[model samples]
Target: MKPRRKSVPVRVGNVVIGGAAEIVVQSMTKADTRDVKATLNEIARLKDANCRIVRVAVPTREAAVAMVEIKKASPLPIIADIHYDAPLALMALEAGVDGLRLNPGNIKDPEKVKEITRRAKEREVPIRIGVNAGSLPGRPKEGAGVRPPTEEVVAAMVNAALGHIHILESLDFNLIKVSMKASDPPTMIAANRAIADQISYPLHLGVTEAGPPRTGAVKSAVGIGVLLEEGIGDTIRVSLAGDSVDEVEVAYGIVNALAEKLTGPNLIACPMCGRLEIDMLPMVAEVEKALKKIKRPINVSVMGCVVNGPGEGQHADIGIAGGKKEDEQKLAS
Candidate 1:
């Protein structure tokens, strides 16, 4: 493997991001953060699924107040997502959360921002300066509107990020991470690249408000996948609007794909062209269903005709292929 680029590792609890550590996977809890029991249950599920860090919305006072119990029960470290109100930031920190997410586009007050930074320093908690092109402010009326050019969008996000950065730096609080997100693939990719060039902070990567399972995965995988390959993101989140567990699953899949070793099951099947052999479809289907329930990273393959199937599936740890007489043969290579 090639060497990692110039980057400092940021510690989220015991897990490390960047600097020779295995990429860390994080997911946000959708349960109302105020509902501690529900939130804890969700967090526990994510933890069992190997989630390294968990983020939760601190939208209201009840949610912010519940951070203490959530933090106590969480198997992984907690990040409080404080949007507009800076007071929630203090509440989360006081509750002993491991980190804070302060969105510059949403946090409008300077004094409240300063106090949040100061208190974060006192509490020794890390802050994530999150930005999304969707939430970018002050775009001119007649221009591209929500879809500003990647460079323009990056500048806006970086400026707001730096503003919050300066406050934290002034108070000598250095545990900072930044993210610049957009719904469109190209915009999301370019904004993150531009921001990485400007700041040395670890980056959190994602495409916000990505739609359903199929399209959302493709968008996130393309945008974020490109960045990770270029050695960009430090921490990543797959912001699927649906099941939070799916988000965790997708994030890990991307990481696994990035790794040199193919850990999980690898599906290799022929398109069932003219050379197809006896009952290849059912054979391949059986292999897939068998491996679907696997939790550990294990590799398997399925193919159609014996001619191409065996050779192609040879790269896999365990594989199955169609054979004569309505039967199939399995291979290990």
Candidate 2:
């Protein structure tokens, strides 16, 4: 991987983002934030799945009030996701949330943003200027095509982030992170690259509303993996519409696939072809299950045929290949 983008480090609870810290993996809880029990339960599962940071949506007054209890019980650092309502952000900071995510799209008042920044600065809590393509600050320009030029979209996202960054920086409050997410990968990649060129604040990467697990993982992998390979992102989240734990798993998968710093065992399996000589699917599944207990990074390959087995599995730390017969299998060392 290319050297990571140089970013000012921001601490969220115990986890440090940017500056020489490992690419952090994070996910948002899907449960209603008002249901403290359910939210806590989801966080426990996310922690088990190796999520380093967790974001909880504080959309309602009750939810904002519940932040106190959830933050108290959450094992991972809790970041309150705020939109529209500035008081909700205040409520979260007062409840001792580790961090805050303010959507510039909906919460347009500069005075309110400054108020939250003052309180967050006093508490030393970091805030993420989370800009989403779907919720940009203004309506599309007149006489625009079906899709605006990529440059226009990219500029919009970056400018939105910079606007928020300006508000926080004005108060000498530099505990900041930024995210420019879009449901589409191209826009997300372009926006992040643009912002990365202009700012030193840590960036949280994701392809927002990236559909179900299968498709979302692919979209996130493409968008996040491309940036990570270029060393453009400081942290990442895979926004799958499924279980929150799957988001953590997919986030790690994207990181592991692109970067050398793996969080868990990396499983390499070949797509079964007609040349296959053994039932490698079951074996791959079994190996994946066994690798879950491992905490360290290792490459383990399971190939289904001899044609590419020797060549493909040769570099892996451990590998298994099917032989001519079902009972015969060879281990590559």
Candidate 3:
């Protein structure tokens, strides 16, 4: 079994983050935060999709005000994503948010961040410091207005996070989460690694602007997946620029992709060779589709014929071998 990295445990409402807790899965709401009914409806959809935590943008006073009702109606804890306006962050906190997120570097004004941290510490709300390649102070300076290399992106994020942490630390606040998101896979991967080396605060892993579902899901899985494999991240977001429910589904997949070490089921299949007689493609797809409904911790195998079938895949907790149907029934059973 792989070891999880050492990280501080940060709680978001009742959910425990970092430090051996199952990686928390989160997705942002697509509905405008000002639209209480619509945002509530969308978060219901995300919750059904298994989103562990939900973040909504608090870009306006109306949204910050709406957060009171939204938080009232929400079944899960709400994390308000605030940028540029520390007042909005302050208002949302008063509106009864469970957690807060802000890019302190972008907040620009020092006094506001200090006050935000003071209020947050009072409420016991954990803060997530989001640092993006597009918003980093030195992103342009580091790469001459082009995309920065991995180390620079990491440096800027850690610097930004540490900057915020310093203010919060001075305010005697300790609960925090941090993320450094990039659209590129390698930069995202490298940035997490670099930050992980320097900070023990829980890390939220994500690749922002990762396109449409199929393409974005692949990129998110690879980047977040690789980081999680290294035991580097605590919470994860699949930032698909689409339905937030899909983001939740992809987030769960990324976290549990390697979870077969203890929980859930894993499927293994063999590609058919010359021994292929039956059209097994549809059969494999059918079984895989059905297996999604199985929450049990078991291993399932679907293999081709005698050549590539049974020998290697027999270790599955359960299995099926494809061949002449009548002869193979007992073997698969």
Candidate 4:
């Protein structure tokens, strides 16, 4: 990968994003934020899965109030996801959240944003200006050819982000991060590439509203992976529609695949052919399950037959190869 783009480091709790920091992995809670107990439980699970930061939706006053308790017990830094309502963002800041994610498309009142920014500056909290393709300011209603072209969409995303970024900068508040997300991979990639060239603020990358795990992972990998390969992302959230833990795992996988810094165990398995002498599927599954408990970056390989097992897995940290008999497999480390 090329050298990472220079950025001003923004601290989210104990974790530092950008400015030579390793790529951070973030996820949002699926549970309702008003359910403090349930939200805390989900955060705990996310931490166990190696999520570095967690975002909770604060759509109502009750959810904003719950941030106080959630932030107190969360193992990961807490980010309140706020949209449309600016007061809830203020409530979350007062409740002492480490960070806030505000959608500039919906919350367009400059005075309202300035008020929230002033409070954030006082508390030294970072605000992520999240721009989504579906909610651009003054976006046209759904109709034939009503949706803007790809170039228009990309420009709008970047413009929205820059507008909010300028707002924060006007207050001399540099604790800022930005994200321009679209459900389509090409649009998402183009918008981020455009904004990355224009700003030094740390970027939070994602493909918004990506479908279920199976297809969502692929979409996220394509969009996020392309940006990371160009050294343009600071933090990433894989927006899979399934369990949030899967989102964390996918984010780490993308980081591990591109950057020199690795977050979790890496697994390598070979495709079985007619020469295969062992049940490779079950063996690969078993090794994958065991690898999850490991936090460090280690490569493990599982091979089906001796024909090319040793050669293929020679560089792995650990290698397992099958002999003609199931009992004759050999392990090398």
Candidate 5:
């Protein structure tokens, strides 16, 4: 991994983002924010999945008000995601949320933005200028003109984020983070790279609307993993269509695969080929199930044949290699 981009640290409740902190994993609650019981239940599940921070939608006054109760019950820091309505942002801040995500493209009034920034600054709450490609302010009419170049998309996203960053900076508020996301992986990666070069604020990474669990995980892993490996991302969220807990799991998987963060056991298994002398699939499955219960970070391998099996297996802390027969199984420690 390359050296991480230097960024000013921002604190969201107890979790610190950027500035030497390990890249943070965040996920959103899928339940209606107005339903405090449902939201809190999802928050608990995300926490158990090792989500470092959680964001909940604040679309209405009722949802904003409910944040007070939800924040009190949530184990992870609660960031209220507000869009279009500036009053909801105020209400969320008044509700004592740990952080706020304000989409400048939707809430365009500078005065309203300043008001929210002032309140968040007073409360020492960091605000994220979340710019989504689907919601770019003053976007060109689709049918009225020729299609714009792809670079325009990246430029527009970065400019939108900087515009919001300017709003907070003009208020003398420096506690900030930024995210410029698009469903397209290349666009998301390019926009973040542009913003990382222009600003020192922490960046929250994601591939917005990245589809179902399988495809979303792959998209997020590529988008976030590439930026993280380049040392550009400070935190990340894997946007999946299923349970939000799966998003947290996928986020950790990306970070783990990059070897940036190690939270659990690392499993290594060889693909079965004609050289295999044993049924490797079931054995590997059983080993994986048992390893998941162990929290200690260790490398465990299950190899099928002797050619590369013994060599790779012996390198792991605990390993099993197959021989000519089932009784000839070799264990390495």
Candidate 6:
């Protein structure tokens, strides 16, 4: 892996992001934020999945108010996502949320942004300038008329984020993180690369609206993994349409696959081939199910056939080599 990008450190509750801190795994609660009980339950599940930071949508005044209870109950640091409504941002801060995710494109009024920044600074709460391709402010008619869609999107995301950062900076507030996301992996990558070149703030990576588990995981892996490999991302969220717990699982998978952070079992299994003398499919599945319960970092290998199985098994913390003998299997450590 390449050296990680250098970024200014910002604290969210007890978790520190950027600087020397390990890349954080973040997820949003899927339950209605107004239903404090339901939101707390979902956050508990995410916390179990090793989610270090959690964001909850604050779409209504009731939901913003409920953040007080949710913040009290959540194990992970809570970030309130506010869009279009600066007042909700203030309410979330007043509710004592650990952080805020504000979409500059949606909330464009400078005065309102200044007020939010002032309140956030007074409370020492960090804010994330989250810019999404789908919600970019419309292009100004005074600007150039034509550009490639990718260029236009990337430029818009970076500009919107910088604009918000400037607003906060003008208020002498600097505890900030930024995320420029798009469903398209290439667009997300391009926008982040552009922003990384210009800013020192920690970046939160994600592929927004990335579909269900299988496809969303792949998209997030490509977009987020690419940035992480290049040392560009400081934190990540795997945005999926399914349960938020799945998002945490996938986010960890991406981070782990990069060898950036190892949270659980690292399984190495062989794809069955004609050389196999015994059925190892069921055994591998069973081993996987059991490994999930073990939190300590360990590598487990399940290989079929004797050709390379013994050597591979010997290298793992615990492993099984099938077909070592006609009726016996070899287990090694």
Off by over 4 Å in 6: 139-148, 276-279, 324-333
lDDT of 5 at 25: 93
- Candidate 5, residue 314: the lDDT equals 77
Off by over 4 Å in 1: 1-3, 140-146, 263-296, 326-331
Ranked candidates, highest TM-score first:
4, 2, 6, 5, 1, 3
Better of 1 and 6 by TM-score: 6
TM-scores for every candidate against the unseen true structure: 0.90, 0.94, 0.86, 0.95, 0.92, 0.92
Per-candidate RMSD vs. true structure?
Answer: 2.6, 2.0, 3.1, 1.8, 2.6, 3.3
Per-residue lDDT tens digits of candidate 3, residues 63-172?
89999999999988899999898899999999889899988568967788888888998889999988787787767454456665667667777687778778778877
lDDT of 1 by residue, 70-110 (tens): 88888899999988778888888889999889888888677
In candidate 2, what are the lDDT values of residues 1-333, reduced to their tens digit? 899999999999999999999999999999999999999999998888888999999999999999999999999999999999999999999999999999999998999999999999999999999999889866354354356667887888888889999999999999999999998899899999888989999999999999999999999999999999898999999999899988988888888877666678899889988888887888999999898777688888888877767665677777787778652334556
TM-score for candidate 2: 0.94
- How big is the positional error of residue 326 in model 2, measured in Å on the Cα after superposition? 3.9
Residue range 1-333, candidate 5, lDDT tens digits: 788999999999999999999899999999999899999999988877778999999999989889999988889899999989999989988888999998867998989999999999899999999999889966654555544455888888888888888989998999999998988788899889888989999999999999999999999999999999999989999999999988987887787788744666778888888888888899989987786556566778788878777787777777788878772345565
Tens-digit per-residue lDDT, 1-333, candidate 6: 588889999999999999999889999999999899999999988887788999999999999889999999889899999998889999999999999998877999999999999999999999999998888878422337633478877888888999989999998999999999988899899999999979999999999999988999999999999999998999999999899988987887787788844667888888888888877889888987897667777778888877777787787777677774652345563
Instruction: Give per-residue lDDT, candidate 1, residue 140.
Output: 26
Residue runs of model 2 more than 4 Å from their true location after superposition: 141-146, 310-314, 327-333
Q: What ranges in model 4 sit over 4 Å off?
A: 140-148, 327-333
Question: Lowest-lDDT window of 10 residues in candidate 5?
Answer: 140-149
C-alpha lDDT score of every prediction, in listed order: 0.79, 0.89, 0.81, 0.90, 0.87, 0.88
lDDT of 6 at 116: 93
